[model samples]
Target: MRKMHVWDENNLIDISEVDRNKVINPMLVFSIKRDGTKKCRLVARGDQQDLSTYSKDRQQDTINNMALMTVLAVALDHNLIIKQLDISSAYLYADLKEEIYIRAPPHIKQKDKVLRLNKSLYGLKQSGANWQKTIKDYLKGKCELEEMRFWPCVFTKGKFLEIIVCLFVDDIVIAGNNVNTINQFITDLQNRFDTRIVNDGSPNERDAVRYDILGIDVEYKKGVSMKFGMLESLTKKLPLLGVEFKKESRYNIVPGTPNRSLNQDLDIPCDKDYNAKVNWIQRAIGLSNYVAMKYRFDIAYYTNILAQHQLYPSDAVLFETERLLQYLWTTRGKRLVWKRNEKETSELIGLTDASHAKGLKYKSQAGYFCIWNGKKLFARSTRTSYVCESSTQSETYAASECLAISRSINYLLSTLTGKKPDQILLTDNTALINSIKGTKTINLDPDIMI
Candidate 1:
């Protein structure tokens, strides 16, 4: 009744099958479209009080952005066509394993009769997970596709006419060399589940603007590149967090001041709206963090520092966040260009740095970024657990941390492409570099080894 046809009279059960103990509360979800439209959908999410008691696990995993980007990189290398697909009413295909009851739709004549759902509906906590599992099973059993060992959401099938599927919730992107094979796969999917092919043409020239997916605009001009910063989602999201700006307002050149750290000594003003401000700050950080990870590697270090003070944000933290937004506004059109490398090497290169004992707790804060095939593959910054006795120890810890992350990434890349490449790690600290290459071994704390 809420614009979603999730329920039908044929699917409704008699009074005998109804479980009185299992009562579910349903709500309407109004989702905003990419085209600035809105749609109301019915969700059969049960009572919030009983969430803890729900037996079904709601944790669902999608394809990691790094893995997804690698897949796209390979597609771009082969000059393969990128196509997006949406499963029409994805949740409806998933059958519920547990007995659940939802209130009848408003138009139903029998007010006393509660609808016992045979299939999963939107708004259920476990709906997304259920749908994911169902599709995984179907793809493997019926479609003859094998999921990758490292990234289970990525599916591969066939040899020369292979089709690779990268899944993010209900959104799917399929890439392959053979057009006929890809069309057949889509046709098969359409026969089983309702499918809506989206972003069908060249992403670069479509809609007179670049194509966007997961808040990142993908352009397929000379090569496949992804852009973010100036997305409409960011524009709408920032204002909702009480951030306002004038049309002619100039933004800061940099997101953060050079070598700036959070001022722990600064006190937060005890205003009546302090809690509201904190919530807004947290939401802003969370939203910005996604873009930073997905596309803007330059801002990862800046975002990481801001995130550290999320629990107890001060006026100084708020000011820094505003500055970050200003920087994003100024560099709105920046993109990560993933050009075609003639060598086609999959080697992983790493660069690492550490601010020795610079954190509020006197712990070292480290940052590392990895590049693959001339594109920034991953970037991460974090606070270290161990305190260093000297600068060398801090640099060692940072280098080791960076190496650990590189190993995991290498494993994924190897599993995906059946090739292992040496990790070329780069660091400014000469002592740390020598230590990794067996030139030196500085005495470090035993506890820090872990």
Candidate 2:
């Protein structure tokens, strides 16, 4: 292990970073590779994910949502954001191929301590791998899966009908521009897995989690949560479990979670000097939740940094995340707005931020945002953006990063959003901006990278 101190370190970099194509998911890769032989090598490998890991004095989800509300506000108006909310079962364990072993839970019932593997558990190592396999297989060639720093895991077919699907364990959130396409996608999905149809008209009203996040009540459930029925009835062409994605909304998922130790500390960041840093963290968290809403993949860097302080962020950290959350709450009613124009075009906008000498570690923070349909998202990823150096050095290095991401987004602008390669970026450093645009004479040497 490396000796790294968070407070005394001289190098601080944004912690979110990821390789979009690799899909580090073990569940998807650990499938039965049938090549005329029986069971081939297990393609997936990773430790199990524990939701309990999120249980702590700090509420990362709440923080992130608060940030998301802001972006959603500016991008969308009083209407337009909608979803097909539905829940078939509480949660189902995923089926697996390998026999990876595991010890029993600390306090749960122990039928047998070291049990074998037949399916995935809340904390199984290959659980995500299996889920990824299923999702990728379902999406294979329809959408574009970006592997670069700009956008990852985005599926598109030249914008005829765009769909953004985010798979989070058992909860799947799919946002699409068209209702016909979304319903068709759901029907096809139900054919593949044991999915409970959502938004069908045969049942009593709406599904739960429609206008709510965890327990915080959302404002626009009709358009955002209850819009699933439009797709359900429209896609009646393909029949699944007796009806289209059924139209039943439930609002009873807020009493308690499997774990209830949350909200112990709102833990507001109370310092005055870190206001800028606080704002940066807020934007990062908001962008992260936005990434979950849209299928954009460039936000891994910022969200990861905000996540580090999930347990107990200082006044410098918590306020930043809170700022972002306020943003999300405002925008929660919005969706990735896409309209078909006679010009046959779309545009992609991006933003990047880097701070030096600001962190307790004296490290720099780097964050970037990718906009699809003017709907913003900081990609959800396992990586974070972090670099150690002086403020000047950190800003310059972050500028280069900003340029790299801009170039990648420029490529996707034509491919995904249908607009020209022109992008707008916002940053606090004028020197970095000038350096990136090549309009100012700034030192950009590799040896001097922070």
TM-score, every prediction? 0.87, 0.43
lDDT of 2 by residue, 114-202 (tens): 33334543334444555555456555644333221234344443242254443433444454466676677677766555576443322
Candidate 2 root-mean-square deviation in Å: 17.9
**Residue runs of model 2 more than 4 Å from their true location after superposition:** 1-82, 85-94, 100-117, 141-153, 157-159, 198-210, 213-392, 404-414, 427-450
Q: Total clashing residue pairs per candidate? A: 0, 77
Computed on alpha carbons, the lDDT of every model, listed in order, comes to 0.72, 0.40
Distance (Å) between predicted and true CA of 427, model 1?
0.9
Residue pairs in steric clash, candidate 1? none
* Residue lDDT tens for model 1, 1-450: 323444556565555566556657667789878777788887776545254435564678899887777776766665666788888788888877766777776667666667766677877777878899888888888777888876768888886326788888888888777787788888888888878888764543342225566667776643444333445666666666665653454445567877876856446667787788778778878977887888888888888888878756676788888878777765656777777766756667778888888876788888888776676777888888878877878777777777766676777666555676556777788777566555436532222222
Which ranges of candidate 1 are over 4 A from the true structure? 1-20, 47-53, 56-58, 201-210, 222-230, 246-251, 266-271, 439-450
